[model samples]
Target: MATNLDLQEQEQIDAVKAFWGQYGNLITWTVTLVLVAFAGWNGWNWWQRDQAAKASVMFDEMDQAVQAADADKAGRVFKDLKDRFGRTVYAQQAGLLAAKVQTDKGQADAAIASLTWVADEASDEDYRSLAHLRLAGLLLDKQDYDGALKQLDAVKSSEFAGLADDRRGDVLAAQGKPAEAVAAWKKGWDALSDKLDYRRIVEAKLTAAGAQPAASGAAQ
Candidate 1:
């Protein structure tokens, strides 16, 4: 009985050895890769958090500059944010804020540069649309009718459809196309949500452009 048990144990040991020999490298590598990937994922998350925190500080500085109405300071801080934390949302926000201050300060070129960066590089589509809208307005102010139209064309977000139409009306009017302007203004007037007070402004624009206002129910 003892000899038989020993033979059975030896057979079991041999089976295990054979299996290990066949799959040892693959199993070892698989486990190593899983552990490495888990560690890398944790490290990546930590890095992102660290980056965001630093970017937040810079954003606050930019905000302060904007509030103070110091266009030069806002532009400088915005440049730093773009250089060091360009991938962060804070950087995108800074660009927009900096553009606003620059525009207010009559630094049209600086505003254009900042808006262009946000329009091109922002990860969020909403921000890109916002940037494009502002850029279109700036281009319109500069009398770059074609460039304004091009910028308006870049804004494809549904949320900005009314704004785009309104901007198009302005561009067309600037190009001496009053008939087209009136049509564009009507579209913008109709596209706006009834809940928005801004729709009244659009209605006024339509009236000014020689387009009769739509019926109240139809406008709503």
Candidate 2:
């Protein structure tokens, strides 16, 4: 009986060896590939974290420059942030800060340039929209009616639709197109929710534009 048990154990060992001989290389290669992929993924995550950490430090410097009311220093720091870390939110925020300082310094053209860059190149859609809106306002202040309208027209957020239309109306009014302004304001009014207090301001604008509001059933 001991001899028979020894023979069976030997046969089991032989079967396992035969299976390994047929598939061992394939299994080893598959495991190697999976491990390499996992290592690469981990390496990429570490690289991204390192990059963001460095970018954030630079952004802090830019913020300090702005807070100190040093327009030139802020501008230089922001330019570096833009060049090095344009994909970072910090870079986009630096642009806004730089633009504000430039505007306060009466550097309208520089402010517009900074804002235009953010509007065109920000990775975040909301940041891009904000840049466009602010730039449009600046252009309107400069009486660049067509340019302002173009900027306002580029806004794509549904939540911004009413405000963009309202700004468009303001620009049109500035250009002596009161009829078109009224029409734009009406569209903005229609797009706004009834519960929004801002809609009353739109109503006032329409009234001032000599466009009578539609009669409310309650008023009737």
TM-score, structure 1 vs. true:
0.90
Q: Each model's TM-score, in the order given? A: 0.90, 0.74
**Alpha carbon lDDT of each predicted model:** 0.91, 0.87
Clashes of each: 0, 0
Instruction: Please give the lDDT score at residue 139 for candidate 2.
Output: 97
- Candidate 1 per-residue C-alpha lDDT over 1-220 given as tens digits, one digit per residue, 9 for 90 to 100: 9999999999999999999999999999999999999999999999889989999998988889988999999999999998998989999999999999999999999999999999999999989999999999999999999999999999978889888998899899989999999888888878888789988887788877677675773444
Query: How far off is residue 148 in model 1, in Å?
Result: 1.5
**Pick by TM-score: which candidate is best?**
1
What digit string (tens of lDDT, one per residue) describes model 2 on residues 1-220? 9999999999999999999999999999999999999999999888878778988999889888888988888889888988988877888999999999988988888889899999999988888887888888899999999999999989887777887888889999999999999998888888777777888888899988788578461110
